[model samples]
Target: MPQLQSHTIRYANPILPGFYPDPSIVRAEDYFYLVCSSFEYFPGVPIFRSRDLIHWEQIGNVLDRISQLDLTDQKNSDGIYAPALRYHEGTFYMITTAVRGIGNFYVTATNPAGPWSDPIRIPYGGIDPSLFFDDDGKVYVTAQQGADYNSHAIQYEIDITTGEALSEPQVVWHGDGGPWTEGPHLYKINGLYYMMSASGGTAKEHREIIGRSDRPYGPFERYPDPILTHRHLNHPIQYLGHADLVEDHHGEWWAVFLGVRLTKDRYSVLGRETFLAPVVWNDGWPHIDNNEGTVSLDMAVQRLPLTAPSTPENHAAIVLGRDDFNEELGPQWLFVRNPSDRACSLTEKPGFLTLYGEETGLGEVGQITFVGRRQQHLHASFTACMSFIPVSDGEEAGLCIRRDEDAHYELGVRRSGGRNVIFARLTVRRESLIVYENETKAEQLLLHIESTEKEYKLACSEDGQNWLSLGSGSARAISPEDFVHKMCFTGAVVGLYATGNGQASKTPARFDWFEYEI
Candidate 1:
C-alpha cells in the first residue's frame, strides 16, 4: 500500500472493527501503536500501527508466545482483560491481567511487533492494569481494585525495569458511583496528573469518566459528567467507554475507545470495536468529540498527515479481504486456547491448510483442531474450499461461526447412513440440532457462510458453480443478550474447524483456501 496524502479525511467510526475492545494507544517515533484486549483467544492482545490515527494496520499480536499466556480450559471472555501499551525510552511495555490464570503481568520488547520478554508477574490482584511513566524517572501502576459496583481505581509505584512494586497500593480515585469503575489510565499534562476510567459496567450504561489532581494519588476533582457515552442515545452505536488518549503529530488530541454497532433487535454480535474521536482540553478537563459526548457511525475530522501503513515485507501481518493459504498462517489467525502442534499444519499439504481432527469438539474445553479469524463485519461472506472425508458418524469438518463453546453454528460434512452428507447444525446452550442435511457425492466441497445483520446462511457446492442452501441460524441466538449465566465478552468468529466428537480420527481435513470479504 502507498502513503495516503496528509489532509482532512472523512472516515467512519470503529476504525478497527470486530471484537477489539479496551484499546490502549501510544505515539512513538511519529507513529501510533495500539493494542486491544483479547479474551479467551490464542495469540492475545492484537497490536496495530498507523502513520495516521484514522487508519491502522495490524502488525502482530503482543502475546504471541505460549509462555506469555495460558488460557487452558478458560471459559468465554475469561482470559486476557484490558491491556495497556506504553513506549518508554527505548522499550515498549504491555501490561495486562490474565483472568483464570495469572493475576497481573507485564511484558517488554524493544520492538512492538515481536519477541516480547516472558511475562514479569506483578503481585497486584486487579484487572485492567496500566503503566504511567512520570517525569522524575518514576513509573506507577494504576488499576481497578474490586469487582463490579464496588470497584475503584488503585495506584502503586513500580520499578518498570524489574517489574518490582516499590510502593504499596493505594486508592487513587473512586469513580462517580458507576457499577464498574475499571479501565484506569494515568497521564500527566501541563504538570497536573489526570486519571481516566470507564464506569457503569461495559454494557448499556458504559461511559468514560475522568478526574484530575496535582499529584498522582489522592484529592482528585472529577469532571461533573461522563466524558463520553451513548447510554441513552437513539443511535446504531452503543456501549461506548474504555478510552485511551493520544496526541498526534499535528498537536491535536484524540481518543480511541470501544463501542458496538447493534442490529435491528439491538443485539451486538460483532463485539466491541475500536472507535476514534477528537478530544479537546477545556479548563484543564478533556471533552470528547467536540461536546457531542457520544460517538457515531461516521466521523469527519482533521487528520495528521494521513499515511497508509507500510508494513514490513517480512512481517506476517494480516492481509485484508482474502487468504489463499499460500504462505504460513498470518498473525490474524487464532485458536481456541493453547493449541496442540498436531492440530493444524500448512506444510502437510503444499498450498493447503490441513487440520487433523481431535477428540474434542467446539462445546468442550479440550483443544479442538480449529483455526479462525474475527468476524469483523456485520455483513460479510466467508467461503472455504475443503476436502474432508468423514470415516465415522461423529467425525466432521467444515465451517463454523463461533461466539463461544456452547453457542455456535456448524456447517460440515459427516457420514450418515453409510452416505456422505452435508449438514447444518445449530448448537446453543448445550443443545444440538441438525437443522438441515443433504446427501452429497462430491469428495471436495466448497463451504460458504454468508452473514447478514440478523441471520447466517450456510450453503454448499461441489463445482463452486452451483450452490445449495443448507439452513440458517439466528444471529440473536449467539449474541450476549441471549446468554443466561454465561458471559459474552468476545465477539463472533467464522473459520474452518474439524472435530472427532469423542474419539481421535485418522483422517485429516485439507483446505485449499479460505476467503473472507466484507
Candidate 2:
C-alpha cells in the first residue's frame, strides 16, 4: 500500500480507508464531515471530520452508548444500515435505519464528537433513510421500501426535533427501473431538485444514478445512464456506487462513494471503502471520477492548504496494526455488542491486554469475550502473543478471523483430553468442523493467520520465529457470499478471543501485543 502524508498537497483516493460504506458526506464551511454504516458492530455510525476531503480523521462514533443502540437480538450483519449526514443551521443531523434493533431514526449534535442525541425513532418504514434540507426551511426524509427492481423511494417532510412527519410520504420516482434501487440523496442546485441514488444490487453491477425534478417530489426525470460506476473498470477498484455529493470551499464539485479493491479473483476482503472523485457538471448533470465514469486507487484533486493535523501513522496504524495495550483503545477496536469496562484491560497486567475469559456461549446464546478490529486489507497478517491456561476442557483462548458468527475460522490453544493443544476450527452458520489440531508444549504462544484475497492460512509458533502451518481455508468461506443460513452484509475481522465453552471461568487471557502487516 502506498502511503500518503497528511501534509502532502495531493492525496490519494480512498481518503477514508477500511470497511466504510454507504457514505453520506457534507461540507460545512472549510470542514467536511462524513458518516458510514456500522452493521452489527458496536459503537455504530462512525463519524469522521476532514479539513480537506483528502485527510479524514475519525472524530467519534454516533451510537457510542448502549442506550442509544441495542442489538441484543439482532442477527449477524443485521444492524445499522445506510446513514445520511447533513448540517443545517447549527445542528448536525444523522439519519438512518437500524435494520434490526429499531426501524428508522435520527440523531443530532451540535459538536460532532460528543453527547449525540439517542435514536429518535421516526415512524417510517424501509431501510437507508436520508435527510434533505430544502432552501424553503423544509426538511425531507427519504427511504427505499422495496428490494431489487421492485424498490421504490418515497419522501416526506419531517420535523427534525421530534421525528414527526410533517407531510405524507409520496413516491417521487421508480429509479429508471434498475435492480435494487436505493441510497437516495436530495440536492438543490441551479434551482433544480436532483435526487441521486444507487441502483443495481451492491454487488458487481452497482452504479450511481441521478434524477432531477422541478419540485421536491414527483415525476423526476431520471438520467438514462448512471453517473458513476466500475462494473467494466479494469482497475483494482470495484463494487462502485452509493455516492453523496458536496461542493468544496473552492467551488469545486466532489463526490464521495464506496468501492472495494478487487484483489485476486475479484475477491474483496477489506470490504467497501470510501473513495473520493471529482465531479464535473456537464449541462446540469454531474459526472464522477473526472467524467471518466470510474474511480481508481489514486485521484487528482486540489489540495486544502494541507494544514498539519497530527494524524495516526498510516491507514494500517488507524485500523490494521499492532497494539501494545499501553494506552487507551482507539476507535479502531470494536466489540460484538455493548461492552463493559471489565471486558478488556491493560492495567491488569502491566503492558498486556487481559481479556477476562467469559463463560462459554452455548450455540451463540451467551456473551462472547473478544475484542476485534475490521480486516481492512486484501492481504493481511494478524499475529498475537497470548498466554492463557484453560481451567477446564472448555476454556480456550486464541486468534479468530471472523466474517460473522455464521462463518468464521479460529485457531486457539485449549486443553483437550489430557494435554494442551492448538486447534483450528472452521464454522459455516451453525455447523462447526475442527480443521486442524496439534499437541503443543508452549505456555505462551504466537498465534497468527495469514489472510489473502482468496485463502486464509492458519499458522502458529512456539516462538515468534519458528512458525508452523496449522491449516488453510478458502477466503470465500469467511465472506458474505458463503453464509449458509441467511445473507450477510458485513466483512471479515481478526481479533483475540477467550471463552470457557459453556462454563464460567475467572481466568483471563493475556495478550502481550497484536501486530498486523500487509
Candidate 3:
C-alpha cells in the first residue's frame, strides 16, 4: 500500500466552532466530506468539504428546507443530536436523529455537496445514527436505542434502495460499566467487522470503546478494555467517546473523536470539540497511536501525506471570525432548531440581517427562528451595531453570550417603562433575569462583549467611545463536554439578534455590522 509520508494535526484553531459535535467524515475522489451535529440550529447538519482535512470549506447543509425535517414547535438545544455521513454507489447519505418530532431520519444526495432529499424517517428508535454498506451491497444501521431512561446498543439490517429495515433491531450490547454507551459505527476490514462507539456519559469522563463481530448483526465481543480514554489525565476535561473511523487514500486509518480541554477550575463552557488520532491494528484488534489506549497532546507519526506549501503572505487569510450574512448563514452560525427561509430575512434588510422576535424566548425556539453563533477562545472581542425600536415593555434587542436561555450574558436595549433603557442581564434560568442598569442612557445601543481566560465583560458605546461597563461575569473556556453546544459549529460568530416578551404583533431588529477578534 502507498503510504502517506506525513500526517499532522493542522488547523488546530477550530475548523468549525460553537456547538458542532460528533463529526462523521467520508472521502470521495480527492475531496473529503464532513458533517456535524447542529442541535437546535436550523438548516441542521452543516456539510463541509476539504481537499486536505486541514483546510475545510462549507458547501451547504443537509437539512436546508423545513419540509426536509420537522421543526415545528421545537425548543432551544432540543433537536437534531448526532449525524452520520456516508457515501456508497455514487450517492451520499446522512442519517441523523431529530430528537423532538421525527426520531431517526435519512437524507440522500447525488453529490456530497448537495441538493439533498427530504428526510425519510426510520421507524427505529435511536439517538446517534450510523450507516454501513457492505461489499456485497448489504446495508445496515447501528444506533443507541432503549427505553426513555435506559440505553441499549442495537443494530438492524436494511435495504439501502428503500430506507427500510429488513429485520427488527436487536440489542447487541447494553451499557453497564459506563453510564451510557451510544454513537456506534460498524466498519469491515480483512473480513472482520468492527464496532466503535462512545461510552460513559457525554460528560467530562466520556470515552470511546470498540467491539468486533464477523457478521453485520451478531454476538459482538467488546475489547477487554477501552481502545481510547481520558481516564489517565488528572481532572482533565471530559475525554473519549463519540467517534467515527475513516481510512485515507493510502490505506492508513484514523479516528476523529470529541474531547475537551479545561480551564484551571475544570470549566468547559465551549463544549466538546473534535480531535484526531492514528489507529493501528494489533493482534486482530485496533489500538490508538502505537498500541497506547490514550492520545498525547503531540504525536510523532503521520497518517496522510502533507501537501506542498503555497505562496507565503503577511498572514493566512482571515478565514474564521468574519461573516457576511449576504450569503447563506456561514458555518459559524447556529440556531436552536432546524431553520427555515422564512424565520430570518437578509433580503428584507439588504446589507443587514433581520431576526424577528419569535413567540418563544431565547430559551425556546432552537430552530433558525432564534439563531446564535458560538463564543470560543479565551481573549476575544464581540461587537455588533444594530438599529431597532422596541414596540412594548419587555422587548429587548442586542448581543448575548448564550449557553441556553437560562445561562447567558446579554447586553441590549429594552422598553422598561415608556423609556428605552440600556440594561444587562445574567440568565441562570428559573431564577430572575438578573438585571444590571447602565448609568449612561441611549435609545439605540452598540453592544460589545469581551472575555479573558477568566471572566466576561460586557459594555456599550454610543459613538464607539466612552464605553460604559454594563457588568462583568465569570467565563469558562471550551472543553469536550461543553464543546458540543457552547460554540457555533463553524466558529464563534459574533452576530445580532432580537427577542421580545411574545405579546407584540411583531418586533424587528437590524444589524449593521458584527465583528469578532481574538
Error of 2 at 516 (Å): 1.7
Against the reference, the lDDT scores of all candidates come to 0.85, 0.79, 0.68
Ranking by lDDT: 1, 2, 3
Per-model TM-score versus the true fold: 0.95, 0.91, 0.88
**Whole-model lDDT, candidate 2?**
0.79
Winner of 1 and 2 under TM-score: 1
Better of 2 and 3 by lDDT: 2
Give the lowest summed-lDDT range of ten residues in model 1: 309-318
Which stretches of model 3 miss by more than 4 angstroms?
A: 1-17, 147-150, 235-237, 289-300, 304-306, 309-328, 338-343, 364-369, 438-444, 476-495, 505-507
Best lDDT goes to which candidate? Answer: 1
Question: TM-score winner among the candidates?
Answer: 1
Listed per model in order, the count of residue pairs whose N, CA or C atoms clash below 3 Å is: 0, 3, 37
Worst 10 residues of 2 by lDDT: 2-11
TM-score of 2: 0.91
Cα lDDT tens digits, model 2, 1-518, are 95443233455667766778898998776689999888877888888888766777777888889888887756677789999999999888998888767799998998888689988888865898889888888989988888877897888998888989988898876887778888888889889999988988887888889889889895788888888887866767877899999987756688989988766666666678888887878988998842254466655454444345555535422555578888877776777766556667878898898986666342373357778887877677999999987757777888998787777788978877877788998886668888888887778989899987778999888867888888888887776656687766677878888877766556788999999888
lDDT of 1: 0.85
| Pairs of residues at least 3 apart in sequence or in different chains that clash in candidate 2 | 148-180, 360-501, 406-429
Clashing pairs for model 1 are none
